[model samples]
Target: MPGFSKILIANRGEIACRIQRTAQALGYRTVAVFSDADADALHVHMADEAVHIGPAPVQQSYLNIPAIIDAARRTGADAIHPGYGFLSENPGFALACQHAGITFIGPSPEAIELMGSKRLSKIAMIAAGVPCILGYQGAEQDDVTLTREAERIGYPLMIKASAGGGGRGMRLVHTASDLLAQIRTARSEALHGFGSDELILEQALIDPRHVEVQLFGDQHGNLIYLGERDCSIQRRHQKVIEEAPCPVMTVELRQAMGEAALKAGRAVNYVGAGTVEFLLDARGQFYFLEMNTRLQVEHPVTELITGLDLVAWQLAVAEGQPLPLRQEQVQLNGHAMEVRLYAEDPARDFLPQTGRITAWEPATQSGVRIDHGLIEGQSISPFYDPLLGKLIAHGATREEARRKLLRAVQDSVLLGVQSNQRVLANLLDHPQFISGEFSTGFIPRNFADHSCLRPQVPSDAELAIAAALFYQASAQVHPASLAGWRNNASVPLHYRLGLEDQAWSVELNAMPGEVYRIQIASRSLELKIIECDGHWATLVIDGVRTRHAYRLEAGQLCLFTRPGSLRLTDRTQALVSSQVSISSGTLKAPMDGAIVDVLVSEGSVVSKGQLLVVLEAMKMEHPLKSGIDGVLKRLQVRVGDQVKNRQILLEVE
Candidate 1:
């Protein structure tokens, strides 16, 4: 085996930071490449040396083939590590690395090209005796032909784009009439996404679990499977939760899946780390799905349970090392689970959110690990995926791991960008997730309309007494008169205080024997003030036997609620409110991206949802839709335009 001295990581975030730890531990110096936006990023700071590649856009930086090759040449690194995304599975990039005499730490260019295609990969799987969904894989495709094919195959089949994964260019057909239209739309999307409109068909299972087997191979042709991971908890085909040693997996089923995966691996001569995915039906029958040629994002859970560093294995294998251990030596241990943290608002349909990370602190505990890519004061730009980090926990049992993970998620404190923290916290306490009976439809099937507690507003009675006391004490010039003012006042002062655009009139009447009677809005409120100092007033409200503390900030009363730390701001007008620009004929960019395609002239007739143009940002394509049925009045930019957040691209009239 030829060992490498130095390696260059061609990716970013937690995966880059993760691979560096593994390679450095094995006596390899790591080199990192960064874009202008990532100058202060965590991974860049973590590497031994860093290089400036290009601007913030991925195409100009991470995906730039020439820049990457130049970096490898300049750094004099022996090998390059493509971390998961951004040209990780591109055959051209792999071939370029090989031609430059630099080892690519992944499968060969041929293996990548074969397994990366959906149709060819399926053909190889079926030839190797792997069970597959009943579908068509021929070149002839049209409305009539596809409709007939769908009828023969069955209803509720999947029209999948043969290009890439991550739920894009895929459609579910439940009826014959919708088949043709869906196929055309799916093909267009696939063509736009993967530069290929070619698609295939697959029978969609009604109730199935998404299971995957992790496999590792060496240059000496030794292959080993490292058990299975259950990724049934997903939303829109994106995995939100993952676990190892699937609760429903049996020894016989594991062997069947493992051997099939091995055959698929050998068919392509796959080396380094990869994952073979499958859909397990309720009857214990499994069908082959697509193969991920790169290291998976959810590899932490597998490592937690198996006590293995898969990245280290990949590095060793890339250096022409043989398998150090046999398959019999691989043993599964305790249960482990991982939850993805993202910069998205669950309440707003999980829309992507971008801002500065003011505070990012997750609780540190034994057996619980957090793989984060950014730090405090870092910006969450709209140019990349919304993912923030992954929280993983391990324990002797599933329940123990669940409890620990839930605690860690609750204790996480993130400010600035809106996140799915509350949603994750609620999921942990859910009965279905705790029982491990969840399927791929768990999120949309249940808890879709769940409403979390909103920020509370302070009641009127709580603020009335504070206003009366403030006026009375301020009137007394001497400290002694203000101190004993409550006892000295004959007729109690009555005053009205405003709280959040509302008013509460209070009357404090002193009766015989120094007894104070308080009236607020025709309702008598009984309260005893135990202490009053500066801006704080402590009192108990009627019907609720609780003593609460209130703070007076800038002529407004504020109360803090427990558990959630919900604050009730009692001011007439808020200090600031977000303002959305409301101007007709002004087109705003939906995301922070660069203009990839301009499809309209200065003046063109357009209808609603018409594709005006296409924007490519964060490796995902977003088509700008026409807001109203009107004419394209103006074209402000052309192809390859660099735009900012909320920048106007064109005008419509």
Candidate 2:
């Protein structure tokens, strides 16, 4: 094998950092590339050398094939590693590197091209005699052809972009009426996301488990299957939780699936690390989904079970090394599970949030591994995926792994930028999840009420008691703090505090250390103060017997609790009126993006949830449907126009 002196990582975020660690450990210098937004990113700062590609927009920067090739040439890098995103599956980029005399550390360009298209990949799978979902793969651009195919295939089908993944250009149509509109919208999204609008229809399996096999191929034409990963726990087609050695797959099923994966790999002469995905139905019938021609986001689970560094193997194969070990030698170890920690609010429809990570701390223990991209004070921009890191837990058994993962989750202290940590913890403790009886619809089925996530506001009596305790604690720290005096006469101390939109004006009499007697409108409450540092305070209210933590930041009060917390904004500032309120009879765009489709006319009458407009943002099309059944009073946008968050898209009367 020809050893590489230096390797250039053609991606960013935790994946780049992950590759850098493995590459450097193998005695190779790593070159990292960054856009304007990632200048202070952890991955760029950790690289041996860094190069600026372009602006924050991915198209001009991360997706710029020529710029990446140029960076590799300038850095004297022998090989380029596309770390699972951006141009990772771009066959054109691979061929470009080949022509430039630089090693593309992945499968051959032909393999990538073959599997890149959903239509062609299905064709290949069928030709290989692999079981596949029944769907129409014929060319159908117009709505009429698509509608006919939808009827022929039956209802409850998935319209998927042949050139895209990550749930970007996919739509679920349950009825014939919604098929045409969904197809048009899906095509537009596919074009915007993958630069191609070609799509294929697939039978949407009910209660399907998303299972994938990890395959590795070497220069000697040897393809081996390491193991399998269960990534059925998903939201919007993006994997959230992944586990190794699928809990449902028996030994017999594993051998069958493994052999099928190897056949798929050899059929395309695939090399490097790749995943062959399949959907396993409730009846144990598995159907070939597609093959990702690069390392998967959830590769850590497979690594934990197999005790192998897939990245290292990729480098070895790229350097012309044959498989060092045979498939028979591979041992499946204990169970492992990983959860993706995203910088988005689960309560807010998982919208991408951007802000400074005020506090970023994750647990690192014997069985826990946290692969992260951001650090304290790092900014999360909207131009990229909201993923911050992946938390993986390994154990001797699946039950042990689940318990360890739950414990690590509780120990994590990720603050600022609303995260799905609580949601993950909730899922970990779910009865179905714990018993391994969950499917793709687990989250939806469990969290249908939504009330569990949104905590009710604390009662006024509770807040007054908490405030009195806080005043006493302050007075104990400073003798004259909570008590106002004139001519040695004691008076009530006036203070302002808040709790989740409810404000309070407290009056207290200071006593000794960490004690105070307070009154709130004919009610007397005892106080006990625990600790205070800067704007944060811990105090216990009399009769409540519970210690509560509070923090004052930017004239707002934040209270932290176990199940949830409260965010109180001071009403001193001018209150900005909501842009769209059904009460005001207005409909607004939910995001900042372009108007990809105008589904309603000026004088058209529509019902609630009837598609009125489709706004594309972050490569996903958000259908802005009518909030209420009424006349389309006004259509404020056209087919092609830039819109901002909360911009009124239309009005209904």
Candidate 3:
């Protein structure tokens, strides 16, 4: 049994919960470690034992090697499972675990270090006879050398950080004119983000499908590939939608890719779950992209098709077991699709959101599965990734899976915070996506006009429903006996509702038979509340009846309907406060984050669209740009200062 009994999961959120489930099912006790922010998280309560590592920040807790090692020691956990982020791919952390005599449920540190660098790994893969893209991996990092290599690799090549992944420190240079500038910028980002400025160049594939073959190995020197996944739909180089059995895959192509992936694993002597990613072009040619030395966030799609528990496999392999199945014994069946549910507003540049969960109802169906750790009253802070969970569906056919996933997305309800649910549904329903003819450029190209995720005003119909709910929840009005039984005219009640930057004036009049007439601008609506139990409501508006969910919290109305989740404020008879306006050239923190860099000082002349400050939040850096040509008037923040959302950082005048 590898002499390890209880396992400690050195992660949080969905992945931590996921690992705990598999470990406990395999007759192993599990320990959970968390930061201050996750004190009451679902994963913490689900563990057999829990420990506090540090504060909410990653560096002080999740990535703190000594703290994690101490937690494992304190809880007597002999094995540690790093769930695909933070220190999962870090070689130093794995080496530390080895020094502490703890089992790191992943590849060897030598393999992690070798694969962590794109340059070194490319050299290794090439030596192992794996097909790779033509690129530059020389040790000389001078601008002249990079520029010359860019010319040799041709225009439209990629400048990527050798030590970076997940879209950081990477750029696409389309012309020789922008090559040097892009190179310097990528270098600076890589130096700051990954502590290394080494860069690599690769010729960009215009519209290749991002596919990866999953490989598993054990202690007895065995390895196998478990099919491939299509990760074509992406935004900012981060995958959004993933599925098993790429629509464009052929049996011959799969075999070739599988063999190539096996070679990659054998080169590193890998001994755990790893992924070899590749770019597949239209001409049936493929090139190795990189290797992920840990389990992927999209591993569930692979599990769904192959009927295997990947986490279970990881546990067994860590316990010094042999390969579960050989190459010829593996089989894939049915079709599966998955979507990453995020706590972000699609209309507002995908800004991460933070708020308490007023309502949480996940859809349940025969073939639909949702993996999340959410509570109705839980507060989602801005301390980590905005990924709430994933919703995956499996069916006999692709269309069937697509239909079930779409319905699952629409039927599920999450309120009190913004999410990309509507945009995900729109992507699934797109004609190109339904036909499986999209590539990695699908989101940006199709959404150039912002038809789907643009900021939208609430329609009169939506407004009517919100007003009715607000009126009922106010508890100050009893209109059953005060109907329109006056002499000739009926008196009306007025209210003002605000959505985003738009507001409207509404008038409601109680009429006969408990019917209410709502008027806003030029249109009027006849609305009747059939039944409502505080949260879920059945309403009939304009001769149409439907059921939906709504909640009133902190003087705001949040609705979850077929259109999408919308939050509205009832500004009727409330005191107003002065605040900083966006048009005033005041740069405020978009979300809760620390100011990592202040590009300019006070009184510095700046032009519109100039990058002024870089705010680090949720494991990403956001360069705040100047909106007006003016001198910086007042600087309220400096590097390393943590600020809140909408808090003023600097002012320009």
Question: Best TM-score goes to which candidate?
Answer: 3
Q: What stretches of model 3 exceed 4 Å from their correct place? A: 1-3, 476-489, 512-514, 575-582
Please write out the lDDT profile of model 1 over residues 1-653, one tens digit for every residue. 56778899999888889999888888898899999888999998888888899988777998898898899899888899998888899999999998998999999999999888888889888998888889876677666777777888998999988876888788888988788888987997798677888888888887689999999998889999999999988887888889988988899999999998998899888898999999998899998988999999999989999899999888888988887779999989999999999887665466676767755667689889998887878988767778888999999999998999988887766655667777777777889889888778888777767763221234555454465344434544455654454555455666555533344556775433423467777777655554456334455455444443434444444332221111223333334444433335567776577798888897798777788888776556667777777788888878988777677888878
Please name the candidate that would achieve the greatest lDDT relative to the true structure: 3
Those runs of model 2 whose alpha carbons end farther than 4 Å from true positions after fitting are 452-511, 515-531, 534-552, 557-566, 571-582, 585-617, 623-653
For model 2, name the residue pairs that clash.
none
Q: What TM-scores do the predictions have?
A: 0.80, 0.86, 0.96
Candidate 1, superposed: residue stretches over 4 Å from native: 141-145, 452-591, 594-617, 621-653
Tens digit of lDDT per residue, candidate 3, span 1-653? 45588999999999999999989988889999999999999999999999999999988999899999999999999999999889999999999999999999999999999999999999999999999999999889999999898889997899999999988899999999998898888998899878899999999999889999999999899999999999999998999999988988899999999999999999999999999999999898999999999999999999999999999999889889998899999999999999999998888788888778899899999998888878788888878989999999998899999999999999899998888888889999999999998888999888766655887678788888888787776643545543332111267778889886667888887565446788988999999889888789898999999898888876698899753688899988866656545566888788888888899998799999999999887777888999889999999998989899889899899
Candidate 3 global TM-score? 0.96
Q: lDDT tens string, model 2, 1-653?
A: 56678899999999999999999999999999999989989889889998999987798999998999999989899899999889999999999999998999999999999999999989988889888899988766677777788888898999999998999789999998888888887887788889999999988897799999999998788989988999999888899899998999898999989888987887899888889999998988899999999999999988898889989999999999998889889999999999988876565577665666765557778998888887877877767877888989999999988888887876676655667777888888888899998788877778766554554455544555445544434445665642453122166566555543345565666555656566766777766656666334556566555544455455444454443344554443335444434445588765566787897788888888787787665555667767788888887889878777678888888
Worst 10-residue lDDT window, candidate 2: 481-490
Local error of candidate 2 at 82, Å? 1.0
What is the TM-score ranking, best to worst?
3, 2, 1
Looking at model 1, report the run of 10 residues with the lowest lDDT sum: 560-569
